[model samples]
Target: MEEFIQEAYSGIFEKELVKEIAETAALIDFEEGDRLIEINDYIRSMPLLLNGAIKIMREDPDEGELLLYFLEKGDTCAMTLACCMGQTRSAIRAIAENKGSVVMIPVTKMEEWLGKYKSWRNYVFESYNKRLGEMLSAIDNLAFMHMDDRLLNYLKEKAKVNNTTVISSTHQEIAYALNTSRVVVSRLLKAFENDGKIKLNRNNIEIIAID
Candidate 1:
């Protein structure tokens, strides 16, 4: 676990801080679709991604789940940091996008390190800024872009995070992430296939054009 932590976060964190994290953090593995954090759940720790991807999502009463962003290796969720600092329940849901592991650092250590470690403080602030930008981009997509364009962007992002051109998700799963109907997603996917943007498979999509 310590070696994994060092390899993942060595340059981002100082040596002493890395040692402390290795000693204090719990390493947890997750499978695809596993919920790491749920809405309204009290956050007791923050996750440092060691491998794979985690999807951060927001739930709307009427629209259901909407994808906020993806956390890749060496990243942590800014929302989790905020909730930990504020001592509040999670407003978003975090699900494992694939089989992976994370080092979960206790919330108690977050503040202590924030004041004690320069690297930790910089990481926290940078995470907040990056996540805020992503949130803004999501809002722009919803308010300005067409559903088809949004869906295309979603596929591109999913493919990038999964490190594959093929997306192994059903149309319904894509619909849930985009907060749209399966019928709508299916129609757009067919149109995308017709336009040479993607290839439709029985249960997956092969992206041909991504920009």
Candidate 2:
């Protein structure tokens, strides 16, 4: 675990901090589609991604789920940080985008290290800033971008996170992420296929012309 921590976060965190994290954090593995955090759940620990990607999503009872952003290697969820600091329930859901592992640092240690380690403090603040920008971008996409453009961007992001051009998700799953109907997603996907941006597969969408 210490070796993994050193390999994943060596340059980002100081040596002493890394040692402390290895001593204090618990490593957990997750499979694709696993729910790491759920809405309204009390967040007990924060995750530091060592491998793979996690997609952060917002859910509304009436509007449904919306994908906020993807957290890859060397990234931590800022929303989780906020919940830990405020001792509040999670407002967003975190799902594994692929098979991965995370070092879960307890909330108690999160605050303790904040004052003890400079690198930890910087990481926390940077995470907050970065996540705030992503949330704002999500809002901007909904308010300004057309659904097709939004869908294209979503596909590109998904492809990038999973490290493949092939996205192994159903149309209905895409619809849920975009907070739209499956029919709408299908229509737009067919249009995308016709436009040579993607190829429709049985269960996955393959990127062709799309970057």
Candidate 3:
């Protein structure tokens, strides 16, 4: 995990600031199926993801979960920012999508770190900007795209984010992201799989090709 942090910082922060922040970080590991934070739950401190991914979702009338996006390594959870601003009842739910490690930083300590480390502060702002952009994009898709179109586009986007046409996520999870039902997702996925565009592996569905 230290290696991952070093790598993440090497790409994003000054070496000295990286060491300072890493030194102050306390690793919190979660198992694959853990629920790191539920809907509307508030955090007293901020957490930095060091390894693996978490799904950020909201409830929809059509389903169990609606995936807003993901918090990958080097990304901070949106809830952290919301909590910092003293907001209650987050519209997003954060669940551990896989085995992961988080660095929980006390809000006071984080403020001190930001004060002492200029580069780290800038890095945080840049990350938040990227997240805000993604949130806006999600809103745009939800407002304009058809459910099937959204699902296909989302799978395509996730493929791009992972740098491969193949990813190990599930139809139900994808449905959650699309704000639709897994049964409908399954029907579409079965057709895609039959058409040789993807393959299903238990809970994980891999898109083999887009075209």
Candidate 4:
């Protein structure tokens, strides 16, 4: 628990605060390909990814799992707020894309912790703002940008955040993120590969140029 707290926080709060919350939380371990949250399920708790990867996705008739995004070690999935706000159904499904661990805090307890600890409140505010920003960015791209610009921008931003040119997501996943078709994503990847800007290896695509 101390290790998880240490990895998650950078002195944003006193160690005591994190320890106190951790004492009341549960550590959930997941194997690869486990569903942590199903669509339309009531989200009773919030998960902070402690290790490995979790995928947040919306299922589609044609595309299957249209990935909304991922929750890495530092990420907290946003669906918990909907539940706490009295929503009965989850908008996305959270699945363990890889073997992982998450620290689960009851939504009620988390609210209590936030009210009692100013630092925790601040942390929650910051995370909320980050999510808001991402949503705004997505809306902006969808409304104003061309498909090529949006797709390239997405790839560049994703690569930047992951600190690598290689992205392990599939074409259909990127298409969903960019609000386009898989064929469009595939065509763009082919163009990039032909121009020596990226490489395609079946389901995974690599952006050869860092920019």
Candidate 5:
């Protein structure tokens, strides 16, 4: 785990600080579909993903939930940091998309690191910037793009994050992530199939091309 952190977070912090993190941080592993954070959960530690990916989602009381973005290797959850700093409950959910490991820093250590290490401060700021940009992109897709375009973009993003063009997701799962009905998702997927944009099978979608 120490070697893993040294490799994953190389150049992000100085050697001494890295050694401190390696010594103090708790290493944890997760399987796919495991919920790392849930709405209304109190977040006391900040997680830095070391391997695989996690999907962040925002819940709506009336509309189910929407996929906000993904946190891959070396990425940390900005919202988790914010919630911990403010001593507030988590408003978003983070689920492991595949088997992965993360190093969790306690809230107290996180605060101490920010004041003690310049690189730690920069990392927090950069995480905020990146997550904000992703949130804006998600908002643009929902507000400006049509459903077909949004669906295609969503699939493309999933493929990109998974490092494959073939996405192993069902129409219903896609609909839930996009905050739409399954029937609508199926209809649009069928349209994409007819247009040769994708090939659909049970519980999977193979993106043939994107125009």
Candidate 6:
């Protein structure tokens, strides 16, 4: 865990604080399709992703699920902190996008670290800032972008975050993330393929071009 943190979060935290975090944090592994958190679930520990990616989704009771952003290596989940610190249940969901490990810090430790370590406080605020910016961008995309553009942007973001040109996902999965219908997603994807923007396979899409 320490070694992973050193590679991912080296300059963000002090050595001693990192050591303390390593001592208290539980090392947990998650597979590709695992749900790290669910709706209305109590957050006992806030996760700091050590490797791979976790997609954070916002679920509406009536509107269904929408992918908000991702918490990748060296990133923290601001929503988790908000829920845990407020003593409230989770309103969003977190799922592992790939197989990876996370360092879970207890809620008590989160509180203690706020006052005990300056680096911890800075980290938390930085997380809040970053997440808020991403949320704003999501809003912009939803409000102003067309479905094809939004879908393309989503695929590009996914590819960039995963560090791969090929994205393994189904039409239904893409539909769920974008809060649209599978048929609509499939149609747009086919159009993209015809336009030489992407190549569609059985369950994966290889991005050929973004522009």
RMSD of each: 0.9, 1.0, 3.0, 2.9, 1.2, 1.2
Higher-TM-score candidate among 4 and 5? Answer: 5
* Predicted structure 6, TM vs. truth: 0.96
Best by the TM-score measure: 1
Q: Candidate 6, residues 54-130: lDDT per residue as tens digits?
A: 99999877767899998889999988999989989998989999989999999999999999889999999999999
What are the TM-scores, per candidate, against the unseen true structure?
0.98, 0.97, 0.81, 0.81, 0.96, 0.96
Question: Which TM-score value belongs to model 3?
Answer: 0.81
Winner on TM-score between 1 and 6 is 1
Q: What is the clash count for each candidate, in the order shown?
A: 0, 0, 2, 0, 0, 0
Candidate 4, which segments miss by more than 4 Å at Cα? 31-33, 58-68, 85-87, 157-164, 176-179
Point out where model 3 deviates above 4 Å: 1-4, 61-63, 87-89, 157-173, 200-204
How far in Å is the alpha carbon of 146 misplaced in model 2? 0.6
- Record all residue pairs in model 3 with backbone atoms less than 3 Å apart, i.e. clashing: 67-176, 67-177
Clashing pairs in 4: none
Q: How would you encode candidate 3's per-residue C-alpha lDDT over 16-84 as one tens digit per residue?
A: 766655677677899766877766676666778887777777787654665667787788865566675
Winner of 4 and 5 under lDDT: 5
Q: Which of candidates 3 and 6 is the stronger one according to lDDT? A: 6
TM accuracy, model 2: 0.97
Error of 2 at 119 (Å): 0.9
Report the candidate with higher TM-score, 2 versus 4.
2
Identify the runs in model 1 with alpha carbons over 4 angstroms from their true place. Answer: none
TM-score of predicted model 5? 0.96
Q: Report the C-alpha lDDT of model 4 over 1-211, residue by residue, as the tens digit.
A: 8667667665775787778757877898999779889887987877777787776776666655544566676678665665655747787878776777888878777778777888878877777777667667666766797787777777776675455777888887677666567999899778878988788887567888735
